[model samples]
Target: MEENRLPFDAVILAGGRSSRLGGVPKQDLVFHHATLLQRALAASAGAAGTVVVGPRPEFSLPGVILCREEPEFAGPAAAISAGLEALARHCTSASEYTLVLACDMPLVQDAVAVLKEALVPAKGDGVMARSGDGTLQPLAGIYRTTGLKKAAEELASRGTLNNGSVRSLLASLEVQPVTVPAGSTADVDTWDDAAALGIAAGNQDKKPGPAQPQLTWEARS
Candidate 1:
């Protein structure tokens, strides 16, 4: 943590209707002996407070705030709004930014740290992770708390938040993109994605004990 870098509070969005993976809750999926939600929480261990926005998580984590977007399964934008509301209670003058993450990204910690470091060199509303193909992974980024709150609120007020896209929520903010490694932006939406990430297939989804790390971000050229 640098003196100039804002203290981070985090919001993990876990409430999605996983229609692609036979309705399995992505947050409940295992990765390296931990649930996807747990891995996400571990990554935010440095934050002042962490909020998990979704239906009640299967596992309990002390000091974590669990919330859900209004109307349920209301997409990322509404989920973000729900997270912002939970965060408002815990944010202080020292907590200037929010680290937003999607629960399904299993290997996002390094990129999370890198995004934090990027904040030191680039001044913007936030530092977002960009995929190799140049798509913005908005959930894998740090945002100024005030700016995010405003954006979330504006979208909700406009009545477009239910199942709304994240891009709409962030349309007004000046976000700097830091290109992250491939799997850092990978999210599991289908069974193939899960299996590719070391998650067992079929009846073996719970083959548990602990799986190994499936990918790591390589150094930039």
Candidate 2:
């Protein structure tokens, strides 16, 4: 792919029932010192703009477009649909591919390159990032708005949107699977999950997660 041939937009799914964290907004929850949304934004900043789908707007960032779901919300699927709809209205084409990343992932590294390499289909296509363990990480993946619209519309028409989750959506399309490094796919869901990331990142509960100096990821394009 050429340097500027970005084939998709990135949608960061922040709308979720963070019941595990006492119903706290996952995007607002801080990991070490950075908020989850901040980490997510940093991870997705270079992926053609970011759209945050969530209920609360209090944690809104500068560059991210915060959008909540309609119909009182169903789940991530609903939020994703809402984001896609809004993105479609603003963009030139609604058929453009979108990389839908969950906001809870603190270990997302080089998302632009990962999604770029994973987006392998001609015309319109979908892709998902898989960990070294081979589990299908549905949230950290891609979805064409056209494909999502089809499924969402169908489900909405039937008066039953229960079956149109991200997992089912990817199953319905020819999705490319990209392999991420071992520790780059942790989705900080529960309190335990965040704690584990802190421990792994060399930050215990008392101390904060110090930003490690590295030459792997450059600050600029």
Report the C-alpha lDDT of model 2 over 1-221, residue by residue, as the tens digit.
33256556667787777777777677666665766666666666555655677754443245456676775447766767777776665556543667788878877755445766656543445667888889878788766667877876766677656435776555456667778777677877677887777723333232223552111211111
Find the 10 residues in a row with the least total lDDT in model 1: 212-221
* TM-score winner: 1
lDDT tens digits, residue span 1-221, model 1? 47345678888998888999888889889877777877787677678867888877544456677777888988998888888776675545437888899989989887787787788777879899998888889989888888988887787788888888988888999999998877787889999999889876444343323332332222110
Error of 2 at 113 (Å): 3.0
Query: Model 1 scores what on Cα lDDT?
Result: 0.79
Q: For this target, which candidate reaches the highest lDDT against the unseen true structure? A: 1
lDDT of 1 at 36: 81
Q: What TM-score do all the candidates reach, one by one?
A: 0.87, 0.78
Clashing residue pairs in candidate 2 are none
